[model samples]
Target: MSAAPRPADVVIIGAGQAGLAAGYHLRRAGADFVILDAQQVPGGAWQHAWPSLRLFSPAQYSSLPGRMMPIPAGGGYPDAAHVVAYLTDYEQRYRLPIIRPATVRTVRRAGARLAVESSAGTWHARIVVSATGTWWRPFVPHYPGMRDFRGEQVHTAGYRGPEPFHGRRVLVVGGGNSAAQILAELSQVAQTTWATLRPPRLLPDEVDGRALFDLATRRHRATLAGQHPVGAGGIADLGDIVAVAPVREARDRGALKAEPMFSRITTTGVAWADGSAAAFDAILWCTGFRPALAHLAPLRLRGPSGLIGTDGTRALAEPRLHLLGYGDWTGPASATLIGAGRTARQLAGEITAQL
Candidate 1:
């Protein structure tokens, strides 16, 4: 027989912002836990982000528990590198126990405990926190003739910079911040087309991640207080896109306008319902991602919506499993830096009580 699984009070299945935050709180609670990271290095998905990608919030606003991310020396929203550095430092500063390149294969019930099986080894724990975020699972919608397209196609996850697309005709799809930001930069060097399912909603210049986080916090507090606050929809009530500097500059240049999504893709380009067609050299799909939860498949906790029903972060079907940082369903804005810290604090407390 193989060696028996290691034992711990908790096993956090990610070392990204969410997992790190969970580790911080669990450590303070004095729980025995280990963080399993799929990536070989530190920084999580942030390390994979495009060099120019920036956090919409300033350093002070985007922070984890017990440590504040240092403000960028140039004094602006920190770039991906800055965030990566902060995360690297945060894990070291706290001495969070992390096992690298440990891709979790499955999480299943083992007697009264949950068994986490990963490349690094198996761990049996009383609780498992799934903080594996969505960056790994890029979502691309299907279109007729998509496979027939002759042009190069890339997703937000694959896009690095606009240097390669210079002088080429490029189609940028999706209407989220990624699409807008990427389009803004790519348009400068390439002939660009913006396509969206509907009109893109642009937030005023004053609105940003900080404001959105504050709104989410108030909404969360109101719900906890058992009060139904008016206009409780939170950030969704505002708009979709934040007017970052690059996007605003692009808008001023009349490059931010969006066209209706094409009905189908052709080998040459895309065609609209009206029969009009445009040819492009390449297509960039700024489409978003799905939660990276395949490792939890063995648990059979997902509902018809392909999501686990959760009472906050606690899975309804498996209370021993807590899903963190997937999105608001886990906790309002839990996918974000500040939000992860807040939610992890509560989650750690709950697990600590049981431990």
Candidate 2:
């Protein structure tokens, strides 16, 4: 038999911003740990973002811990490719111990510690940092006769750009940022139709010079506590954020339409609950995503609204292996790249203390 696998002090899953941030702190503390990533390369979901898409937050807030993104003077929004490159540079510059392409299939509690099962095999660690952000699992709504529509159906994860639907009728579903961003861009080429489950409230992407970000960090908490309500309350209305950008220009071009969500699809195209069906060449589903924690075994976890519960309602619901990038713990910024650094730092502290 080969040598027995070495047990690490910590094992971090998903090498995104939070994972990398934890790695940064762990390395600085000289802790024995491994950062395991499922992707072939780094950058997490940034690698999967639409090629032309750029970060809404200016570079100042998008940097990782200890280092800042080398942003130019004027306000500039770097695209997805730029972000991926930056993460690569961040990994190299910081010498983060990242193991890539090793997808984690399961994480279970074995007595006191946690056992991480990945494609490579099993890893036993004193503590685990589940830095898997809550955006990968797309929320594709089920419909009656949805599969029979015959037209192509894809989610935001599958969307690359609008060039595919040039001069064609395309239905973009959902009312969130992904939907808005794709709608504003696709309207230039395709006859676009947007649908929502309900009329979503809209807020400015940035208010008082702040881009709404993750919900579990300090900045997010301060913004929430100071504000009348927390969050953009979900998706922002087109009219709210359209004041200072090209969104207004797109609306005037006759390519945009704001409406309630699509209920179903028909032979013609898609069917709305209000007895409306229109012709469409393709349908883009930007319906957002759900939290995926199915891999956790033995350790009980409770998920409501796609968020893991840390508080004790039923003692059995405790997550012996806790999750960090779940949602608004420390406020809105904790869940996003702009403020994930803070969450990662907190997680590192928790892990250090646990070990």
Candidate 3:
């Protein structure tokens, strides 16, 4: 057998918004840690977002812990490229120790510590923070005869631009910001159909991320005070829709209407409950993603919901391991750029206390 590797104080997985936020805090507290990112380049999941995708919040509102994202010269929400550039700059500014293309394969108990198996090598970590968000795990619900459908299917994760879809019949599915934004753009190019489980909740045009965060904070406070709170759910619940320009334009153009989900996939098209069928050249699954927790599968800590049991960011079953930015279960609005900072600060404090 080989010699044992020296243990790190903490090992963070994914160099995205969450990992970067955690790094910001840990560095502030003078902690020794390393971040492992599967992507070779900077900007974690933002690198994969579609070209036209813009943040729901402004640059000032969508910043990490230490540094604020610089607003554009003109004025508007920063798009994916701008966010990616900000992330790259943030990493360089802080000089956070991050290993690139080091894909973590598994993590398991190693006596007093945990052994992290990755493409780079085995890392022994006293504490591990899994910040790998849901971009890699796009969820496409199964429908009857889906396997037999001859047309093309692509998840939003794989979607690049809409030029190739010009003149094609496409179905956009989901009720979130992504679905709305994509449906808006796609409608401009392709003959599109928007499908959702239920009609989407559109926030008032004036409502934005700041308003949403404030509302969520109120709900959280109310919940702690032993009161029943209204609108307690996903960041989407705060303002299920952001009235972006393209989406608003689509609405005005009568292209933003959404219908209930189809009953099944047919060889030639999708079938409705009313026994009607509509042919489509392709289906774009805007359905959201599950957490990328396969690396923790060996821990067997996941519940039926495929979520690790957690008290705040700390794993309930494995105290040494903390999960950040997977979803709301890890922290309030933890998945967004601004939200990651709060959770990262709290988790850093917890880890510091333990250390």
Task: Quote each prediction's TM-score.
Answer: 0.97, 0.85, 0.96
Worst 10 residues of 2 by lDDT: 235-244
True lDDT of residue 345, candidate 1: 96
Q: What is the C-alpha RMSD of each candidate to the true structure, in Å?
A: 1.3, 3.8, 1.5
Winning candidate number (TM-score): 1
Q: Rank by TM-score, highest first.
A: 1, 3, 2
**Candidate 2 residues 139-250, lDDT tens each?**
8888777777877888998888888889988888876666767888898887888877665444443441143443223344455467544434432412233222444455
Write model 3 residue lDDT over 129-234, tens digit each, in one string.
Answer: 9999999999999999999889999999999989989999999988988999999899988999998998887777777777776666667667767888656564
Overall lDDT per candidate, in order of appearance: 0.93, 0.68, 0.89
Best by lDDT: 1
Which of 1 and 3 is the better model by lDDT? 1
Steric collisions counted per model? 0, 18, 0
Per-residue lDDT tens digits for candidate 1, residues 1-355, read: 6778999889999999999999999999899999999998999999998888888888998999999999999887888999999999999999999999999999999999999999888999999999999999999999999999999999999999999999999999999999999999999999999999989988999889988878887787788789895357666589889888888899999998899999999999999999999999999999999999999999998899989999889999899999999888898789999999999999998888877
Show model 3 residue runs off by greater than 4 Å. 1-4, 233-239
Which order, best to worst by lDDT? 1, 3, 2
